[model samples]
Target chain A: MPAKKLNLRKRYGLLTRGMGWETTHQKMDDVFPYDSFEGIKITDWDKWEDPFRLTMDAYWKFQAEKEKKLYAVIDSFAQNNGQTNLADASYLSAIKLFITGVTPIEYAAHRGFAHLGRHFRGDGARIACQMQAIDELRHQQTQVHTISHYNKHFNGLHDPFHQFDRVWYLSVPKSFSEDALSSGPFEFITSISFAFEYVLTNLLFVPFMSGAAYNGDMATVTFGFSAQSDESRHMTLGLEIIKFMLEQHEDNLPIVQRWMDKHFWRAYRLLALVAAMQDYMLTNSPMSWKEAWDVYFVENGGALFEDLSRYGLKMPKYHELATAEADHISHQIWSVFCSLGNATGFHTFLPTEEKMAWLSEKYPDTFDQYYRPRFEYWHQQQKDGTFEFQKGLPQLCQVCQIPMVFTEVQTDPMQISYRVTEHGGDKYHFCSDGCKDIFEHEPEKYVQAWLPVHQIYQGNCGGPTLPEVLEWYKFTPEDIGNYIGSQDHARWQEWTGEDKEVKQA
Target chain B: MSDKKNTVFLILQDNDDARPIIESVEQDNPEATIQYQPGMVRMEAAGRLVVNRETVEENLGREWDVQELHLNLISLAGNVDEDDEKFELAWN
Candidate 1:
């Protein structure tokens, strides 16, 4: 008997654990381009299995239903001329970062998840990966469609995807994602699902949704909230997958820790964009980097660690480093925005005196002493046209691909700690050796970082100058920076004033 | 072969608040057929959802910002055909 065929119950439960896992996975030929993703491997399809136990019907039913709900809101808004009464066009400035930075990351996710759907060795993993692939596609499509309407009425809504590839600071998100996608299946799960999905998506999503509501962008708010709901499932998958891997073998502990350390710093570094948006981008309801990190990292992470401590992995290596970092990211991002605001499509007026006072009060530890001085300098230099750009090029980390952000903590008195590793006669610089240790475990792996500086020196990004490269991108002047004092701000004021009078009448 | 009874599918209130929103949907899709009842209006569309600000402005007594319409929507059922637009509702 060539492995006697058994009943469904003998192999897996009824519509549970792994139903249609093998069959649908075997249908990879239906999707095309499978052979090209990697070499042919029939065993790969057998390895695919879903943890969520979701079959095709449930998947389509849920997705179609979700799309319908989302479309209804869009329809209702259009029917009601809901776009007109927006609190401020300045609000779209926050989305400018998404259009330029975070949105493209979804495309990267699509590519990565599609890869996972192929290479993953079980039906459970394959199905989840496929669903994630579709989710990424849905995200990209809906975002473009939503933003297209604004493109008609607004200025900066054009070719953002191309801009993402060539832009300067945008390399932060790009390099971070490509690094994760380049990794093996296990590390990809650790970096993206565990670190990015569960740990950081809350930080990104909550603020985006809240800001959309405050600015009266209903469709963005609705879609963001709905998308985040699916993200919770992905987060759970990350949590379960991580614990499952760790428990499977004792040898997995150090391996798991190395990945945890590596991805924590990598993910944290890319979140500089979120840090910038929270600190500087929003015109009306702004959040500070410190406050967001406190709630998102310290509090949420504390709870998660309590849950995961049983798995032999500890809280991320740089918990102290990040907690110390809270004091610095806001001021750093605000500085970047203040310098670059003029060329940006978003607005960045000086914080109102009231807002300045609030900042001083909120950051009682360092705001007035460290951040306010720069505000005063820019206030004067902006008038004098003497503000200088930190031109030339930023030295990106070998692994994370962000410009080096590690520095001595302002609050701590006597610690100049940094992490580095040397492998095969080449030294790699990381913000934390936590990342470097992961790299050293397999030096052949991370040496191929797509650092923008390296790329420009290699003539990869259409010459180094910002304007020259911007030409190679899909961005207009409107998609670049700060939100206040922009054309949209003027229109916001114009529309709000007229609406007020009508309401009063 | 033919099952048709003068169908009353949707109901709407004609308060001035909703006229702008109701009218905007009608104008954008153009094919949307609307029925009006005492203190209500019922509109139906077999196609994609359309929410353009300019269309709503042409019909209302006065111009209104998009956020204000959240107060006017009572209930919705069925599915939204296309979701490329932003939506608002009354919720704290």
Candidate 2:
């Protein structure tokens, strides 16, 4: 005798619905609460479809298989001394940024999804979030395991979890993820799942994964492919939630649209680091930041929004500004990072001739005409034994908490964009209109931002001197300074028998 | 097929994982024409090209997720209308 066969449609409904009994002793709000804070009315929760149609048995089976294969690759990679196979030692700088900034956010996402899984009203939505929560946790673990191998052979990766909480630059991602974590269930899904995952995830994942493939980092490339397979499911959840909300009630549309506006800009600001890493860090880069942005954002995102317009939702506010800035943002951000290199972990140096040529070719309008001359000046300064690092604290945006480095949209790339507003009799500064709008919407929230640079100036971060600050950041001499003379660079030269002067020239 | 119906196509990396999805598309859209490149398989249909979840699950012999198509998706052209039920590519 064989087990009874059940159709997937029936099984999905039965298994997912489980057995819910309405509480008679307690009010519905008191029992299953946290759904109505944003006034998103839901008349029919059953109409919310489960896209994956995943059950616990299938989930565990597939997840176990993914982990098994990934661990196998990790083992083989370690056996091969995989660190020595990258395109160049400087390539590790991208990984350094990733571990310090992005990996911790994966953990934050895990916590956020867990909260959503527990709190959402819809059973389908709860199951979806729970699966994603587990997926995020898996991502964080695999990322730590994958990058920990590099920490053994590298300088800047040793204290990334600590760095994520305390470092000045890392506060960008820390604050961004914290914002999502602290939001209500509806806002969290709209912000993280819908806006960040749907509209902006490709910008973060594709370049780094493709870069990993090109840079001879088999471990990271393997993990990236595996993570992206899950991300495909995550992307669908994003689309589904937005549609579900819009279809549920007319009032939900405005709320969802406002969330779309707020989170789109927030997610875009976070990816500034990715864009800079893609364009400036990778020695054997696959594509320019502008190219990736155009392909992923302008074309693909444009199409996605067009598809959604039928639901009465519009493209995010300030979208045109974001598209226009793609040509210049990465260059602008890298220039800022280079100017402040001494204060940070991970080495920074002038782009090699080939890289400079690539930048000029890829960004003919901005790189050659505007940004290249500045890099040339920095190189000349380096040649004259007068390497400069930006000193004095830069102002932080109240909402975004990033340094005021962004330029005016559709204008000169050098002039820093700034906006000022008065809330509760205290003036607030923002880097762009997007940040300003966010601050104005919730002045109480933005005012409470834990700005790192401000904390340092207030003598709140470990101490007052450079050594004191570096000690507070747990940075070694090898971790901070020019890449040309860093330990990683020296080891690369020794391993490959390549001359530093020849490579630099 | 109707007038002014341009061919819509999807290119997925040719791999073991994509075989079931390719088969699903082939079965779902009877008129779909598939071509093989060095490491990719491109499928084109005259009006609309669809990859069905039910068909893919049958081919995979297990539960199939519609979003899993992105695992092997290299690139695609035309307006995409996707849900749990199917992934359809068309001009309109």
Winner by DockQ: 2
Give stretches of model 1 more than 4 Å off. Answer: A1-12, A16-53, A79-83, A341-349, A383-391, A410-446, A478-486, A493-505, B1-92
* Model 1, span B1-92: residue lDDT tens: 12221111122334565676777766665766776532335555442344555566667655544333323332221211211132311100
Query: How well does candidate 1 score on lDDT at residue A337?
Result: 61
**Candidate number of the best TM-score:** 2
Native interface contacts kept by each candidate, as a fraction: 0.00, 0.03
lDDT of 1 by residue, A180-285 (tens): 8876777787888888886777677665465566667777766665566466556656766676666655666776777777788778877866776665555444
Error of 1 at A304 (Å): 1.9
lDDT of 2 by residue, A1-505 (tens): 9988665566677777773445689987886688888788898878887665666666777778778878998999998899888878888888999989988998999999998888787888888889999999999899999998998888898988898988888999998898888878889888887688778877777666777777788788777667766776777788888889889898888988899999999999999999988888877677788887886777667766766787889999999998888888888778888998887798887787778898888988878887888899988998998877988878888887888989885866678898999988889999999999998998888788989888877898889887788889898878998888888888889989984742421
* TM-score of candidate 2 relative to the true fold: 0.90
Model 1 Cα shift for residue A298 (angstroms)? 2.0
- Candidate 1's displacement at residue A110, Å, is 2.2
